[model samples]
Target: MSYVFQFGPILDRWPLFLHGALLTIELAAISTFVGLAIAVVLAVSRSFGPRPVAWLIGAYVELIRNTPLLVQLYLVYFVLPKAGMRLDSNQAAALALSANLAAYATEIIRAGLEATPRGLVEAGLSLGLRKGRIIRHIILGPALRSVYPALGSQFVLQILGSSLVSAIAAEELTAVSNNIMMETFRNFEVFIVTGALYLAMVLAFRVFFAQTNRSLFRWAA
Candidate 1:
């Protein structure tokens, strides 16, 4: 007997897949932007702040970077309850994803910040620009442009990693696929569809990031 391929069952439940795809996008978008914001702050603090602040931020970056993301997800969803703080699966997923991405983004942005030339900074100061103004107007643009490609790669990884949130019952793409597979017993078809959705999402993110890089950095040159 030969195995028969069937997609009819999977196709009938397109709505569920659509919902999962949207949820995946939502989770990735929110976490990536929030993570980037937190990463910028951490990088700036580590780069320019006092010694103690820098050390604390450094420790956080190391801790998150060294540990596994799954462990972090478990810690947020399972461990926090013992400390009297409880979060739902989706909330925990978002928190873990943001923190995870921030650790890596912090280092990427910090490298860009470090690569900034000292002469420009001095020139900005001589022109009476405030410290914050100098960073915002003079340093930030170039630094971001320098690291934008790395950041884009990280964002795509984050979007793919969102699939792991299903382990916490977050109802993301993977979780939704599991449900469909159980219902239809079309494991191959279901996973193939799920994988395609993830690929499409990653491609979309790449395009979005590319456009952003062009538009934001066009004036920097």
Candidate 2:
């Protein structure tokens, strides 16, 4: 009852919040796009590529999954500089997030591929289709469609996970919030608004994903 709340300082900084939020969205979108591309490749390779290649892909998936993302981010941002491949904070953040997302999505997609009936693949083969063609034409779409929901969920997690990128000073929503909190010294009010913004972003994306699922995969229903 004694704590008086003041939001004027936070509200006055709307433009900063907007900038930071847009950056957050950009980070998540880039990761989702890049990550999905990588996931599809890894999943297909692991499922149908040659044994040695598949084993390498499997090892990659397990390695990424077992490691903490913070470590991955550090390696990309900090360690790579020593190797003569330096990326700025945002570039590093995007790369790390994309790599992490790719691993989990790969597993989800693999499960979907497994659930697909083998007969369909056999049918494609009987038609003289190459195994690669069979995977591309007859297998990839259905396998991905079956797991779209899971992939979408992983993307949502990636958005939240992006908050962690602030550790490298990527200037995303959380990083911006921290800056504002330091200046305003209103940690309580600043975080409450920041949390609300995150919730709104997540909900908005969920709705978009739901509508997209309906339009894009309605045939699956």
Candidate 3:
């Protein structure tokens, strides 16, 4: 049982691995941004919109939350082409991941909204604040601050989940690892390095979020 270990080949392809890692970060960034936008819309609507609209949004949340993400990716991968909305692998992955993230993010944001006391709105009204300004400055800001940790954690999950886009040949970190494994026949080493890269990225993102949380919510602190 003497299996020789060699990382020289894997190390030699540093450029490939670096490219893949950057692409993975790119995918995560795209999905998180677009998903947060969608989540904000859905959350505000769910929290304050009419009953029928809330119900529809609730249905979407349930459907996306209950299903496997791979299935959702497959649906986007196959369905759009037939509908004449052509998108490449990366675009499709970004769209699918964004939708998936939005569902969970909507719930996170709505919970923050719910935790806000009704008296805050009343207080804003008493202070001569218009409804729009109250919602923006008085309500949403605090609510978003309350939920920033959860949202940041969700983005980390998004980064990890970007690995699945390899299923559609999106050429992200995991996809590149697979290619390296094939070329070097070093599945174990390839994954170990890829996992390390992912860990480093996640830790870096957590630090960034921490600093941002301090800067953005210093008033609350």
Point to the candidate with the largest TM-score.
2
Per-residue error at 94 for model 1, in Å?
Answer: 0.4
Residues 91-158 of candidate 2 have per-residue lDDT tens digits of 99999999999999999999998888989988988999998788888888899898988877787898
Tens digits of per-residue lDDT for model 1, 95-195: 99999999999999999998999999999999999998998898887898899989998989987889999888996889999999999988999999999
Best by lDDT: 3
Better of 1 and 3 by lDDT: 3
Give the runs in model 2 whose Cα sits over 4 Å from its true position: none
TM-score of each: 0.93, 0.96, 0.95
Pairs with backbone N, CA or C atoms under 3 Å apart (clashes), candidate 3: none
lDDT of residue 196 for candidate 2: 93
Error of 3 at 177 (Å): 0.8
**Per-residue alpha-carbon lDDT of candidate 3 for residues 1-221, written as tens digits (9 for 90 to 100):** 98778889999999999999999988998899999999999999998889999999999999999999999999999999889999999899999999999999999999998888989999999999997788888779789889999999999999999999899988799999999999999988889899999999999999999899889888889
lDDT of 3 at 61: 99
lDDT of 3 at 139: 78
